[model samples]
Target: MAAPVITVSNKSLLHDQWQLLQPWFSYFDADGNPAVRYQLWDSGATATSGYFWTPTNAHWPANTTIDVAASDISNVWLRSGSAGGSETLWIRGFDGTDWSGWATFTFTTIPNSLPVATVEDQSLHVNQWARVSTLLSYSDANGDAATKYQFWDSGTAATSAHFWTPTNSHWAPNTTIEVSAADLANVWIQGGSTTGSETLWVRAFDGFNWGAWDTFTVASTNAKPVVAVADHSLHVNQWTRVGSWMNVSDANSDTITKYQFWDGGTAATSAYFWTPTNSHWAANTTIEVSASDIGNVWIQGGAATGTETLWVRAFDGTEWGDWDTFALTTTINTAPVATINDQSLHVNQWVKPGSWLSATDPEGDTITQYQFWDGNAAANSAYYWSSSNAHWASGIAIDVSAADLGNFWLHAGAAEGSDTMYVRAYDGTAWGNWDSFALTSTNTAPVATISNQTLNAAQWAQLVNWTAASDADGDAITKYQFWDGNAGANSAYFWTPTNSHWAAGIAIDVAAADLTSLWVQGGTAGGSDTMYLRAFDGTEWGAWHSFVVTTAV
Candidate 1:
């Protein structure tokens, strides 16, 4: 048989206080309350059948009302017979179609007693205690039988709720946990397991039933503390100021600044002068240097334009004795070499009367001192123990320049011989006779060799080693010059490792790297234009003298 349609006055009521469906004949108690009896079946209007047991809280008067929200799903029942309660109604609802009943109940009954709030009591800790519950739970005074406990913050229940989260919420029995960090964003709840870390919490409940989640948020971050210092340098021309320092180190205080001095990218160790000790090395000090103090400052050519390095350093005092050195470069031009006259002078004639002298260095090393010496030998004089003939230019010429004449004689520092100072000339083609002149050397000059000394790859050449070349007046031979005929006077370049620029040595060594298409020249006196190289082999120094490598190779 089909269950009969039923009706009731109130559609919704206290979920705990009422129940509406009754399919069979039922009786009323002495107070006219619905009887908690049940019948097995339904026949005609007599209506029998279907039995139910009475409920524990079915005795509520008809006028009693309570909220019908999901939280109030228990605490109500009706008595059916001597067995006591039959059914529990979640709310007053029995429309004809659906007979689904409701029961707002607790698995664990609410305790007969209720917890009381004190000035301060925590629920989860030893010293502190609290009374926490969902909106669904109620005290015996509210006709309910379950009890719960948790902290209740003076702030909103939400505060108390989210605070206990990420902690003991899931344990069978609630627990207490200490808070780690304060809520920079939301409450910070710390919890962990014996194994490791547990999960975090999203929401908490304070009422008998939680309405919606009151979500907690993560906190903002804090910056880390650090200690630091700063350095600054100022560069002006040649000098560098490395120690004017100002520092802001940390949040609390500033740090002291230390400084160092460097030359050509290298630092000086000694603290000759310092405001603060250079050893300890601290801020704000100056080392002054003159722009002109930078000597021997030169840069190698061949790098890309403007890619030159400028090096600078201080020379305590002895700049000449190897001081700090630096090299600086510029797009500036090299000193110009200009020619006025035809660049040719006859024997016994001056070199162009007087043309202005001009030439510059790539980095500008001064030509303060000049020399002009005839590169020839005296009568009966050997290559060693020779005469003073270092005039920067000798009677011989490996690389002779038109400008070299002025550079050799006038610019060079050498005394005129007893006869006269002369220069052998190469006028475009063949070698001319000696360029004669008048001058007085204190004594008779030593005889010199003037002969062709250059040779072919497998050819042979001779060498001349003789006695010490003594100066009549007593002047010592500071230096001696010898050139193979391969290097001619006035040529642009001279052979190397064998040219006339060795210290006065009794024996000299020569190699083929020094052989050239041109030959050496006689001095201003004009010696033989064709002669092998010779060094004075004074037995006083050592009787060692050698000719060109061409002699052996």
Candidate 2:
């Protein structure tokens, strides 16, 4: 039999020093016999003087030579005897009787490869903290373990911009930190004041060299908006716009697109809320969706009273933010108002100043008391009287009586002048401003004149002159009246003094008429008769004047 001829051998095996090498070969047999066995050598063309190939791997076993069937000629495995160097392998095939010429193959091993870094993107809120270990991973081609990591932060890139040292504090850019300390190495980075995004770069090191930069996008979340307001008061049953009372802002400078409002108390009702155009909405409803729609947003105060809370959340064309609170006090009560006009009355006359009182209360409260007093001034010293407080003395400012506010009298005795009185009103909660009542007294009676007159029987006589009436107040007499004092059958009578029959108590026109038919019959008994006369100025009457008429026998 002929020795098998080596036909092909693996050219070279290039791999890292830490990885195993597997070489392949092909051979031919003489006389149609299949090549069944193979041999390997470490150096120059021969297996005698040089070291023969041996397998250190337990799967193939360490041996002086290798055994393989014809079907497995290409299944040769080899390992580097030392670290990181080029080596040659000699191979030949045997056909049971003879061996083939040696064929050469080379194995090249390189130094430890650069570590490759892997990192996942991260999302963090502004001004928040996250650990670096959770996002970073690495692998080495030469079996070199990653011992540390480095980072480049965009925030402080111009200054201390790298992070490498082991620290629990925020990392500086391009500094190294132990991988073991990664759990403790926290990162706290922030974006601008308003809502926005940001990123960071990181790489791993295997104690020799840093790997390629692995990126981790630190996408900062949108910053939440803030709302502030001072406690406010509302009158019962009153409506007010809330835009001017609230201050809303966002750090990202994002346009505020929407807001949600809800009442923390019962003071906020659905019917009480209104838009700028007076449209109503439910409480806790999100409305005013536009950025410019904040003005004149209306909220009405219900009949109820007390403190109310309003919670608000705003959306800056993004996710909704945290809730902000503001207080709306609904239980503010306002004092009532009292109004009165200057009052006037005659001397010894009584009037109800309460009838002139006008009172108003913002809370719809009723006026519970009407207070009267002298204002500690000369005008307030006027004499006033009431059934309950018979007569109030001068300068008496103290409330003489709580009653009789409706039927109080202002009397300056007989004096004719003006005086001031003050009145105030009270609702259940508070007192109103004082109002003044001015009291005045005027008018005096007139005097009537008449003289005793004599007339013959059967002759016509003119009665006492009605024009002789005079007034102490310089007023002209407005009317004159007369009555007969004579009894039946002797009763003196009077005509219209214009020949027309006149009646008592009927006003007589003094400018045109006097008694012309006043006479006694010639056959009738003759005697003296009495008559009464009275006159009136515009306001009061004068005392009666007495005169007599005598008839001749």
lDDT per residue, candidate 2, 1-553, as tens digits? 6777775444432232223223345567757666667665554222212122223333333234555555554444554433345556666777777888887766554544688877686655443334455556767877777776656666543322223333444454444434442442454344333334445676777766778887666655666777667666665655666666668787756667877666545334322567755466655555544556766567776567666667767777756777777666556577777777776554445555666768788766556676676532444234657676766666555342335466665554344567767777766456777777666666677777777666565555455442366766576666666666665464345665464544434444443133333432221457777767777675566777777767666
Residue 336 of model 2, lDDT score: 77
Worst 10-residue lDDT window for candidate 1 reads 41-50
What C-alpha lDDT do the candidate models reach, one value each?
0.27, 0.57
TM-score of 2: 0.31
What candidate 2 gets wrong by more than 4 Å, as runs, is: 11-14, 17-23, 31-38, 43-76, 80-87, 108-113, 116-124, 130-148, 151-175, 180-201, 206-209, 212-553
Q: Number of the top candidate by lDDT?
A: 2
Listed per candidate, the RMSD to the true structure in angstroms reads 34.8, 39.8
Task: Give candidate 1 misplaced runs (Cα > 4 Å).
Answer: 1-205, 208-553
